[model samples]
Target: MSTRITGTSHLKSENVNVWFGERHVLKDVNITFPANQVTALIGPSGCGKSTFLRTLNRMHELIPGAGFAGKILLDGTDIYDPQMDPVNVRLNIGMVFQKPNPFPTMSIKDNVLSGLRLSGRKTDDASGLLESSLRRASIWNEVKDRLGDAALSLSGGQQQRLCIARALAMNPEVLLMDEPCSALDPGSTRRIEETIVELSESMTIVIVTHNMQQAQRVADETAFFLAEDGNPGGVVEFGNTEDVFNRPVDGRTNDYVNGHFG
Candidate 1:
């Protein structure tokens, strides 16, 4: 398969705050995701990292009573504009969840092409798209011979890559991953990390992970979120990964990175 790079776009969150009905989950979160780079959101559990990520593609609104304030811009256009369709926002910024979730009954090829079919996109070169997407996800060689096999036949790591392939097939400009390797074994985690690094060369990626080491390995920039004293979550530090890890301005950030506390 030829090396095909997906187009990328900058994503920015400007004064973003999120709430679930009366309870605030995220507060004044501001971050910028550079095109063709990987930005990792790192923090402890329930720090609203996932919540902030969902807002990027408008997935937060899927929950009843969940809403947010402020701008989520994709390449200078606000995704939450009244005229902007959430479906289209999602199409441009695809998401992969914490677990590997391939369609159990669908063939591997069908799983990869599912996003396009759901979006009603018509393309004469679907097979070509499938090959390229799988290759981009670094799973083409493993599953190419078994394209017609059930997606569940693959191992856990392969299943996750297949899910990524499905997202890539949509030609999304940005990819959001929420603890994508949390459920996989160490070897699988390493493979997923490799895929993340490779994909970052051509797609804007924002990943939420509790694994500090993983963030250090795959992210170019890192944003550290924190929730304290029963208050809402917010970013305490944001900078290049090395700076954030080695020279954090905030004591909280330094504590978290050095395994002092989360």
Candidate 2:
């Protein structure tokens, strides 16, 4: 069974901003990701949605001078504290990208076990773990017979699910996806979208997407981000998915979704 999440605020950003050298990317934005819900972050290009996503897991630290202000909390504990290791925060918050980035050298089964082994876990039910992870990713029925095949050999859609399964194998509490469908055909995108909907039943999921229709289909809540001043981006509106889509409080949101100016 998937371990029960304690329903803590899985992710919280309090007055967070990000910078790269002289450029400020994300503005003072505060948001919380609830347990077992999917939150979609939508915006135009360079709107800082992806920047905010990277900050949630401290991925910003990898870039030179990519400093951040304010606190990001996970499970009510401050993740920005010097005492907290970024690796530990990352272990609990996994990420997927726009492109299917399966380990080119690892087999599907090995890819799933990679995180567990990397974390120094031993004496686990590897086969059962593989089964559960694959099922959670909604690709067990498709790849059950080819577990030993190289992950890179799977179709684009299958590789994406395999990436999700690999993240699940680590037993993370939150999964972050950045435009996961941007690289796929329509059929593959639908399959992955279905997989995300199912996974959100057990994990907190946050996605950065340009596809308004796709966000409507899977996200429980939607957040709209707008860039202003050519420096930092901020949230323009946020609400229940239905409310944001059908009755957005801001005209910008309605215009953007209706194919007007981004």
Q: List the RMSD of every prediction in angstroms.
A: 3.6, 2.6
Clashes of each: 0, 0
| Model 1 local distance difference test score | 0.92
Worst 10 residues of 2 by lDDT: 1-10
- The true-versus-predicted C-alpha distance at residue 240 of model 2, in Å, is 0.9
lDDT of 2: 0.87
lDDT of 1 by residue, 119-206 (tens): 7777899889999999999999999899999999999989999999999999888999999999999998998899999999888999
**Residue pairs that clash (backbone atoms under 3 angstroms), model 2:** none
Candidate 1 has a TM-score of 0.96
User: How close is every model to the real structure, measured as TM-score?
Assistant: 0.96, 0.94
Runs in model 1 lying further than 4 Å from the true structure: 1-8
